[model samples]
Target: MIMLSDWHPDIIEFIISKMQNPRILRYLLENTEDEQIKKAAQDKLKFTPLTAQEQDMYQGIINYKQIPGLGGFSDKIIKEAEEKLRTGGTYSVHNSEFLTGANISVCLTSDFMEAVENDEEYSLRFPDVEKYDEEEMKFYNENWHEIGDVREWEQMGYKVRTYRKMRAKELWNLINVCATYSAEPGIFFIDNANDMTNAKAYGQKVVATNPCGE
Candidate 1:
């Protein structure tokens, strides 16, 4: 048996790369602070090809949900998409290209559709402003709205930045851009979806669908 001291970093990393047991790999991923060892364990866990049996086991499983709606878009999100587009050296009229590249399917709600029809403004709230540390406060102060008249939020024991609103024309423009450029971001009436769902009686609301629309 090899002593613990006999196992050098290179030997441990080689062993980790060859390790087939997922539990040991996961334990090393979580418990180890050595960055190289952690990366080796993570790479082994993440990049290893699944066997035919493993693929068959997860064939029909809906493991991920993509929930994108009106409230999901923000300045930070937009900037990230812009940076990604720039770095990728791709030019597109719509940001939905990023979502498509990321394999994210959007399901717009009834409220979003109604807002488009009625020309209602879209509002975004920055929550938990009171909990921000110095660095966070500085970043938000530079990038987001200034804190003002937070009496209502403060009364509720939560301080927040002044809410921002986008005009109805902007929302319509987004839809038109998506339609023209990407032909994506599918719409689903959430109320109708929940009404048809069997889990409503269990006090569970259907918020989003998996990639397979199940």
Candidate 2:
């Protein structure tokens, strides 16, 4: 027997995850001649997060370890991660509850934060880099040989390098390479047919329900 009753958790999961919630039944009932297409799930707009509440929710989500049973790491890292995210934007990973948890699988090359301080010989590295002003010099000092902030240049008609993990159609390496640096992203991919996830709301954060949704 196929159990067909619509459930609340499933509905909530569907709303946030954007994977399983079916609007087809509603569409059929509303537009087609199917009287038998009764509402499979009750209206879930009520369960949605309010703007202020969502802000607060994102706040706690960025620090998932705060949940009583979800112990993971220090709040400092959570804070740092959030602060960094403020500049970096989402790094995919929108599969659970938060869009950009604390990791990533892919990111634009320019997503790296400008180096505020770095030590490297300028002559052998970039002789032309010396012409820039103090702040630019400091940035060069901080990120020599490192990919130029091609992220911004990407918009200004310059070529940009992107990274990938799986051998799909893309450029650069997958985001895991960031572990080599100290700024890796944690991701949670989602798809309608195969998207059943159980995040404890534990750890320092959970994945985003829908990254682009935000």
Candidate 3:
């Protein structure tokens, strides 16, 4: 066991962030003067029912949901999970302290473009769109991996193209939100990156770049 005195305030706050063990948490709660750490500890005590095992494995599993924008998870599922966790349910958040401080980058392509073209208010929320060159368009077209049935749109005589509007309104929305919260979400032009990567010859798509997008 790491001694309480040996741990820095930040480390103590990190332990508080992962307050799965009430005994250890209570010890920290009594020892620490940080309000945020204390509040986190209190929240854990309020939401989680104490068991002999400390951590509720099954409850954590049932309450699991991925964070949206950060992941491709739907809003509905995340909402349901939040509801569950809100009312005396347990959820395991790996490296929860990372939420406090971590270098995170978000990538988007097709969904962003679609929102900009179709959603009027969404479009007005950000910068104006500009046309991409032929080469850029070709790369944009190959960026997002198509899923589900495309035949229906084709049969209906609808243009089932991906690069019709290469707008960054939705991406801007993400950037703005991150900016508001003082979070770092470095933009990665995944489509262009993938097209230019030497990994293409080896039959690999570069879905994400390095932390610095190098």
Candidate 4:
């Protein structure tokens, strides 16, 4: 098999043009002085078609009600947990245990201490739940714009929502659940993770960690 290092410059350019990773495309667009490469990146970013694998992953995330393996908690899950805490109901650890029992450890992050200490609104943007059909996907691709925040999406006529502010009491209750019951949902300092990540230079943020915190 031909090695990737042996690929021609034209072949590599073609591969980069087909890439779906917006971060890499955006980096090339902004950092490269080559007009042709910049145009290619811009075109790619304007209409990123989801690959079969990406479509399946999105479906799995929706179906499982959680991201499989070690990852940051999606805003939907976080909102659910917040609701449970607010209602004096304990959040369920059965899911975490189920994954752990299957040899798949789950870890999640929250700015609990930061929220409590700063008395900040522990708000999170709700995740997109719509399953797009081919036509819908085409429409989305045609209108796709890089949204820096949920508010920008909303401004672009996309439906968006945010979770209510989480208080110290609710966060403490979550901590209590972790302390007394399952230790599967280990606390991850996401802010620190992103701050220290070298990926930041490439316009990427660290969002998850492996089971062993790698």
Model 1 weakest 10-residue run by lDDT:
1-10
Clashing pairs in 1: none
> How far does residue 75 in candidate 2 sit from its true spot (Å)?
39
Task: Assess every candidate by TM-score.
Answer: 0.36, 0.15, 0.30, 0.36
Task: Single out the weakest 10-residue window by summed lDDT for candidate 3.
Answer: 1-10
Residue-level lDDT tens digits of model 4 in 1-214: 1111101123223334224345555566666554545665566554334556755555554454455642565767656544433433322211222222321221223444555667554444432426556765565566543333343455666654443443443334333333334332344455567678899999986545655672
Clashing residue pairs in candidate 3, if any?
none
Error of 3 at 119 (Å): 3.2
Tell me the tens digit of each residue's lDDT in model 3 across 80-194.
5455544445534334454444444544444444565775322111111135466644543564233112332245333344322223442344344433444344555555666
lDDT, candidates in the order shown = 0.44, 0.30, 0.43, 0.44
- lDDT score of residue 99 within candidate 4: 27
Kindly give the number of clashing pairs for every candidate.
Answer: 0, 20, 0, 0
Per-prediction CA RMSD (Å): 24.4, 25.4, 20.5, 23.5
lDDT of 4 at 89: 33
1 versus 3: better TM-score goes to: 1
Per-residue lDDT of candidate 2, residues 67-114 (tens digit) = 764356467766755654463332222232433333223221111211
Worst 10 residues of 2 by lDDT: 1-10
Q: Relative to the unseen true structure, what is the C-alpha lDDT of residue 31 in candidate 3, on a scale of 0 to 100?
A: 59
7-108 in candidate 1: lDDT tens per residue?
Answer: 111323323433444455566566654455567656656433445564443332212112354245555555544444333332222122222333223334
What lDDT would candidate 1 get against the real structure?
A: 0.44
